[model samples]
Target: MHMHVALCAVLDPSEMPGGYRFEAIENLVLSRLDRLPPFTRRLVMDPLGLDHPHWIEDPEFDPIHHIRRVSCPAPGGSHELGRLVGRITSRPLPRDRPLWELWVVEGLAEGRFAIVAKVHHSAVDGMMGAGLMVNLFGMTREPAPEAPPPREEEHPVPPEPRPSDIEMLKSAARKRLAQPRKLVDLAKRTVERVGGVVERRRDPELAHGGTPLTAPRTRLNRPIGPQRDVGFARLSLAELKAIKAAVEGAKLNDVLLAVVGGALRRYLAHHDDLPEVPLVATCPIATGAGRGNNNVAAMFVPIATHLAEPEARLEAIQAATRGAKEEHAVLGKGELLQDWADLAPTTTFSVASSLYSRLKLSKHHRPVHNLIVSNVPGPPMPVYLAGAELEAAYPMGPILDGAALNVTVMSYRGQVDFGFMVARDVVPDVWRLADAVAPAFRELRDAVLGAPSEASPERSTPAE
Candidate 1:
């Protein structure tokens, strides 16, 4: 299955007389593509699924195929952009080619445009994705040239040949024969890990935290359809930092969790579907260092949605996240999830995945978590692309079978951009939830920085 992750960044008009033309943008993207890391040009798996998949260069690679131009409908505002993004993301990337694409969107108001870049999760994680953005863009509008002069007789390198099905089957049989020893080793590690987790949970300080399979069901936790809805909101990073500094032991992430918790509470209440227990969010933490992809771990964070007061909710979230971090630490920093994933037979996994999706098993079982909330740190310095300033960047994550909502925040130069991805069938009114994010943050801000005076206009208005 193709699990595509995408991010759209709105950019100021390029420093050209008539704004950027399709040909100029396309040429710029092609020039940068030549310098992209080798991994970005490869795809996973082979024609037959008899062996483990690995990345290989595409012999028939074409920059034009992956990069193109599109225009929004009339009135060309954020709503039009969101609808276009939703439509672009609904379809899966073609498996016959490289699993990434970039679209140069036009026809927006204020002489602005947007770039939507989509890459498969199997290729890059949050950290790698951020690094890719930095590499593609520049710190200044007029960046110095770094590439060497092109040769007139350059030839495309041929990709390595794939293994035959017979050879793959033979190798699989040998691996299966050796599973007895692998299973014994896996069992020992599993026991040790489970023991450590159990011991950590025994601490009275951490015992109250939510665990796997304990998340409360909400409208967001349901089987999702192929259709998606995208919404966006922006927050002042400066204000968030100020609020974090004011609150004791509060970090930016903690504040974000609390704000999202508040928004979810209001949204569910509006639909008369608020759960009695606090909602849980699966937070994906990047474990990779520089340039590595797919290196991430997760922790279940209690959003404290049940708490009515903003301060109370923030405090509860701080405590819950603290415990969750402690538990994750006890579990060790090893890639335990990836280690186990290596044991799954590819054929079996493919079959199981197909059946699970076809049967709609997500609706029958209790959700593991209500939703996914992730925060990816971006460059604090200004970033420019093709001589255009990056005004804001909002990342959209893939929705799973049970978890139908994904909220991702990317902190850019001086602002935080939020992207809400929801299943269209489950929550078509996702814009309402996105709109609530700013007000929720304002509530937390008021609680931290005493209520504003009645005469002040800022007290009544929420930050945009």
Candidate 2:
């Protein structure tokens, strides 16, 4: 039930006067705490059984507890940093405090440093997380001090009174009493939506989107343990755009999926586990509205890994994603899913999730999807943090019980960085899969560009 979204960003060493210092980093974090949105300081769940879980200000909020400094082993490189991140991600955030942690890591080779930020998925979606980063970071290497606007002397506003447990229970009971009518309304809307979706599917031109429960099972789709592993890869955004230009109606996302398909094909073949059928990926699409977090719906895209030729795989992925997008549009921005989720009993959901984990029920059924593949666009220009130039950023999403692999790609500056999180026992050599992405993109580049000159290795930062 603890789903956390984490991201790591590498910073240029030259921007800082002798690289990053713990004192300076701590001071910067403390200074920005007051400027953060109020939600960042809130904790969820009520101590009394009065109302459903809600956010309240953390009475004992401590800045030092949230921001920390860590160091890597000597000759610190991507491998050490990635291993540290894996360990950090495996640990659940403390429930009694705000659900976010930021680690300022030093000792990277060549005097470089990294910042790893983890926040509960309940607090922010991918888009909101990126927005928070932009807020905390600076647009320039030497950002001017934020000045508070001058205000005339006035009486301070009084603090609002907190609701009593009895009052909260009364309000909740009233809402519960209305559930029957709400359920009826929801049922009617769901039926109408399903009918509309069916009508769209009946159209011959819009039938390519595959049906649910049709995804082929693979090693990646199985029950997972609590432990996890993470790896990272970087690709040239320019090359991805170039490949997209070569194919009509192809987008950056389509090219990324094709590249991932190629990489998965190679990795699975090496392990003698390549499936005859194409692998399916659940791509999370933003609904653009929610409580400001978890505002996403998902679509299943068939990654044409079974196709031998890179060009054919790219083309198949493009068509598959196009159909998925159309299907998502017909579904109307995931309103149905959200509506049902809103009515779900919180205690029942928590108990069910815990039981499912303990019983390992993920292994009992056919997989709904093989893995999660998400793409989030990041700042096109370089960003700075406390005077350090940000070099690269990689986002890591949560791995579910049935889906052991989560691949998240973020485009920053001129590069597309890929973060892979996997079940430690299932994918011990996850770095191999990450390393395969570079050559996979190269193969696609050769297919699209017509010539096979040496692809620039500089475009990639493979985990060692």
Q: List per-prediction Cα lDDT, in the order shown.
A: 0.77, 0.79
Residue 413 CA displacement from its true place in model 1, Å: 1.4
What's the distance in Å from true for residue 107, model 1? 0.6
lDDT of 2 by residue, 1-464 (tens): 34898999888757664455666665555556544553344554434443356665555666657888888787788878888888888988887777889998888887788888999887878887788888778787763234322221111122234456666667667767888999999999888877877887778776355556667777787778878888999988887888899899999999999999999999989988888988889898899765445799888899999998999999889888888888777677788787777776566667788998889887888777888899998999988887888888989999888888999999998899999998887788888999999889888888888975454455656223
lDDT of 1 by residue, 1-464 (tens): 33788999888765742456666556556566545554235645534564556566666666656886899776677777888888888888876677888888888777788899988887778777898898788887763234322432111344566555666677767777887888788878878987988887776756334687788888898778899888888887787887789899998999999999989988999999989899989898865533235788888899999988999999999898888887776665545666666677666677987888788887887788999999999989878776777888889888887888999999987788888988888888988898888788888888888863233232111111
In TM-score terms, which candidate is top?
A: 2
What is model 1's C-alpha RMSD?
3.6
* Consecutive 10-residue window with the lowest summed lDDT within model 1: 455-464
Candidate 2 residue runs with Cα over 4 Å from true position: 17-19, 46-52, 143-162, 452-457, 462-464
